[model samples]
Target: MTMHIDAGPRSSIALTGTEFAELDRLIFEDDDWWAMPSAEQAALRHRFITAAVAHHLEHNAAYRTFAESSGFTLADLGAPGSLVRVPQFPTRMFKRVEVRSVRAADCDVFKSSGTSGTQSMVWRDEPSLERLAGSLRPEGDIWRTLYGDVDLDDDGQMVHLGPNRREADGVWISYIMTLVEMFAATRSYVADGVLRLRDVVRDLEGALADGKFVCVAGPPVFMAELLRHMSDNGVKLSAGDRMAVITGGGWKKNESTKLDPDRLRSLAMDTFGLASAQQVRDVFNQVELNTAFIECEHHRKHVPPWVEVIVRDPRDLSPVPAGQVGLMSYLDPTARSYPCFLLAEDFGSAETDNCPCGRGGTTVHIDRRMRTSSHHGCALRLAETVRTD
Candidate 1:
């Protein structure tokens, strides 16, 4: 295997295409990933994370300096419980600066939804983008396994509640949603920033009339809007066991319109005539991270083996006990264009016990996003300590 090193102030030790391919197979293609033993999974993740850290140390000058200041070294990673010492960038930092380990010219920039009036900007090279897509492959596999009866082929249709890829260019959520198009035929109901309720009803009604398996997917807000429209118009589809509703993103955009997960599921069951609560599933992702944690049939979000999630006490950034709500942090090894080890501003807990769904490993529960006032002080402190430029 040949190795190439770039020479510059922002120099990087680039992984070869063959190396990336091997990593992708190990991380994303393994069929028995969720069933792997914890020790074996940890050892595998530690190896990849160590290499990822080394790559970022050579590529991202600011992150290297922060690591050095924190007395973190590659040797330190050899000790037990050393992974938590890995310096983490606050997720909000991406909103304030461009954090990339690869050349800007080689990256495609993506922005967050910016519901808070400020959007995070992330750069992804082709390799990182490929990994992002690969992370979703397990989701499709799990969905197929759970809903084996559903014929999710070219014959089935996916009714996307968001804009098409081109219409939502550079928007991360839309990009992730449109990826489902590759699995089956998809049609978007939103056009020019407006949700076409009539179009959505027509497509869904047509699908039910033909007994075709259909998936309605997008953010929960749009799903809620569709449900309300259907309820107000007294339109209900009896597509029991033939339709699925997949929701992602946030449940609450604001206080007045907060939609509980159970509420959303119930409304979906009534509005679309879904067979069970299992038909209404949710997916989790963020602009700063490359991996996606998808809920299984049991409604538990299973964390993939390639990444490690730590719930940290918001005050001291120390790891909290499992099943305790705190700030969520991740050590994701999928992104070659950037360091994805990040301290997110979301409140969540992790569970390591076996799930009823039979996927044995860690599962995460995303409670809610930390309020701005709650996280701003911590974010500012972290920013002052880590120099990004």
Candidate 2:
């Protein structure tokens, strides 16, 4: 495959279209239940990650420097051994550094909301973004296996408490992707710097009044405020209606309000009239990682086979035993712009044993993020604004 290499800051190292198509086929294989055996999946992932590492080492200068500094060689990655040798960079590094394997002109620069301080720039080539879009091919099948046809139900309404994609910068892509996949009528309460609380309440109450299912989604802080308002205003919803409230990101802005998961679940049941606690689908995701660790009915966050999770000692970043919470790090081969190995700021425990849900993958439990990490971002700023009003 022919490629253009530049000598300047925009030095490029990206997979060709053909290479990306092949890699994507392996990474995003359509398996609804992800029922592949642990041993087979591990073997496949090992090969994929090794190839991914080699690709980055050859193409990405920043990743090569980081790997060499960490005492990793391409030869070392060639062996069939523990993946622990691969170096994982901190998530905060993205905020301060610009690392990519592709030229700036060839990428779509996605910026964070800058809720805390400065916005982070994450570059993605068209191929990576297209792969990301294709990765969800199994999502519909997985949702069907878990929540049944409810995800495909066209009668439901999608209510987003955050800003629309156009107004949210690039940080709201995940939210917008979810909204689009719902394939139902949708509305955003906060968009273009406007907070239509009354309009949201009217739509929500009207939907419930007509015996229609409503899917409420957004940041926990915003959802908490909506639920609190619904409860205080005595807006009753039908328990018989199919309702689900999915919350993501952290509760940093609502930390002062003490947003308890149990309390929120109770509020969802009491005010929004959700039928089960499982309907409150909390997820563990970050701007750095594309895959989301969605909580199942048992509240266990299952790590898909495409990536591996490691809990490391916070002091020295050494791998800790199962059940011991520490730094949450991931090795994802699907990421192409930069090194897929990432050390997140959060602390979480990992269980490799099979879950009761019959899915045999790494199950993670994130305790919380390290307090020392940076907090400036668009979501935090939006949360602060929403909370103040």
Candidate 3:
């Protein structure tokens, strides 16, 4: 499904299905290399985000009212300066407002379990979900090619370190759960808030016994727990240069535990028997946005080509320089169902400086969730409940 862009005589811009398809194709089907033509990439993001802003202005009345009140309209988004002027709703507003571009009947509802036990509702129609899926498609197939393992197909092993899909509570968390489920031949959720070290290590042992490549993914805190257990029990396992631990959900749950990432990596290398630090990947994303910022070889979370990330001053919500730490907001053209340009509660730095990975996109360095916000959602709760010891 494509967006219905009304380009009347007075309309700022009208993009056809062909335009969307080309953008989708460019984003999904392209090869993953470091060299992205800077000029061409910028032009593509500007065109796509501008058209998306116009689409939201046309279809979402609440968004339109908010945009106009904030002194923005479809007419105001062509130039770079005006484009940044696109109004952003707070990410938490998704909880109280049902401001969707699609009709209620056409949308599928998803919920985010807040840290305080309240759930926030997110509505997405099929088309928007398709766009989200498209953004995620590229990373799903990486493991097969990681170790030159042609035999690794749907039958590959996936050891999940967090809640399973049945227990997943947010869009991004569920997205990762589904991706791991789809690509891995066999799957296991290591901990159900109760770390069963023996069972977890046994599954790892089975996956590696036959010289198979295994894709292990979950919140870093849980992975840390597993690493601690494996270290204590003297059970070091190996996949012979064919295993990877993809960590997500950050170290929020272990803030009290003081779980160090460097130590976690050290334990992972010894416990999982990964070839090198490159075999361990870190992912950055939140439920409010459609894209997942995967770490490159340099460990930079490069923003995908189709999305725009801006670092803003927390007090005034204005743009900051590349290196300065501030609130991280996103302008995502992929979501036609709701306002995708959202000011997140995350604190981070967005840099355009040359990365050793050679990828041409903003590299985001997330510091932590905003201390003032009460919306500590699913992953944090999962982390807090885990019985690490």
Candidate 4:
């Protein structure tokens, strides 16, 4: 089903696997290599915002009120600065406010685990929600293609950490379940002896014995627990060439744990008998949208033009120079059902300089915006996840 329902208000606004293609082309395209041509890309970004404004005016109660007051209209809004003149409800308000796109019979919701030391609500239309669901397929299929075939059991054997399933019962429940299904599929490989980890290496060893690739992905703190276990057990996995350990969810704060990308890579290579960071890529993404950009070993994330990642000064929302670390603000021109102009809490700088890898365009060097803390002594920076008036 494109949409997954929960008992009540917690149901998800997710799309289906079959619908990912349409959404993919809408927001992201394979041709979006490097940065987008400024003029063309900006035009698309303008269209996305125009669509959201029109949608809000038509269906969203909160936006309708604001639009009416601001004299919002369907004119060619033509410019980025002009688009911002339109109101933006900081995403955080969803968790506390009653704002919605009309009192519909159906709405999708996905609530974060509050793991980021914050609580928030992520909403999406059915089609966008389906695209979010389809994202997992590409994410999983990429791993599967790299490692060979994997297996999974329908039974909930592998534990899903952070929050309970009931927690996924948010308005965007489909996105949450898509996350659940992804976990199930990934863990199935382990259950079927396809991948190994500190908690279930032996089960995954069966896959290794058969020459299949294995993958481990989760928050850093969660995986660190297993890495310590694997280290003590004298099980060195020189498997980086064939195995992958992708850690995301930023650094788990509110807890005194630390996992640096370099250190994490070192441990994976040492314990798992891996090779280089190239085999393990860190992904940058969010719950609101379906785009997932992978970072190169150099820690630079190459973004296509469809995705406009702007590094803004933390003190002021003005743009910052390239190569300088600052707050990450995004504009995804293709996003529908939701506003594409995203003011996120993620901290990182645009990679304005040329890369030895020959890939060019703007990219993010770091994103401490979502991070509560880090081991590196870089001056602390925080962007309001959502600053609602």
Candidate 3 or 2, higher lDDT: 3
lDDT of 1 at 129: 87
Backbone Cα, N, C clashes tallied per candidate = 0, 9, 3, 34
Cα lDDT of candidate 1 equals 0.77
Compared with the true structure, what per-residue lDDT tens digits does model 1 show for residues 1-389? 21222324554446754445556886566755777687877777777777788888878876787799988888889965678988999987777767778887778988775534367778888878888887777334567754565656745788998779897778787788877786578998767657788889988999878867888888776787789889888999888887888887766655775779999899999888878888889988888889888888889998888788989999999999989999999998788887899999899999886689787678999988887732222112212222210
User: Could you tell me every candidate's TM-score relative to the true structure?
Assistant: 0.89, 0.87, 0.87, 0.69
The Cα error of candidate 3 at residue 249, in Å, is: 0.9
- Candidate order (TM-score): 1, 3, 2, 4
Candidate 4, which ten residues in sequence have the lowest lDDT sum? 378-387
Pairs clashing in candidate 1?
Answer: none
lDDT of 4 by residue, 313-332 (tens): 76867777777887777755
Per-residue CA lDDT of candidate 2, range 1-389, in tens?
21233324444545555444656765466554357777766776677677777777776777887888988886676555478778888877777777677677777766656544445566677665655555444254444433456543556677887777676667743343354343467777785565566677888878877666677777777777787677677776774447777777675543565567778878887776666787777765666775666677776777767677888998988899988989999987776776668998787799876578777767898777677645634455557655323
User: In candidate 3, what are the lDDT values of residues 212-324, reduced to their tens digit?
Assistant: 67878887767877887887888887665778778876566435755566677777887777778777877776666766777766667777777778889988878998889
Model 4 scores what on Cα lDDT? 0.50
Residue-level error in angstroms, candidate 1, position 309: 0.3
Taken over the whole model, the C-alpha lDDT of each candidate is 0.77, 0.67, 0.69, 0.50
Q: Return the top candidate by TM-score.
A: 1
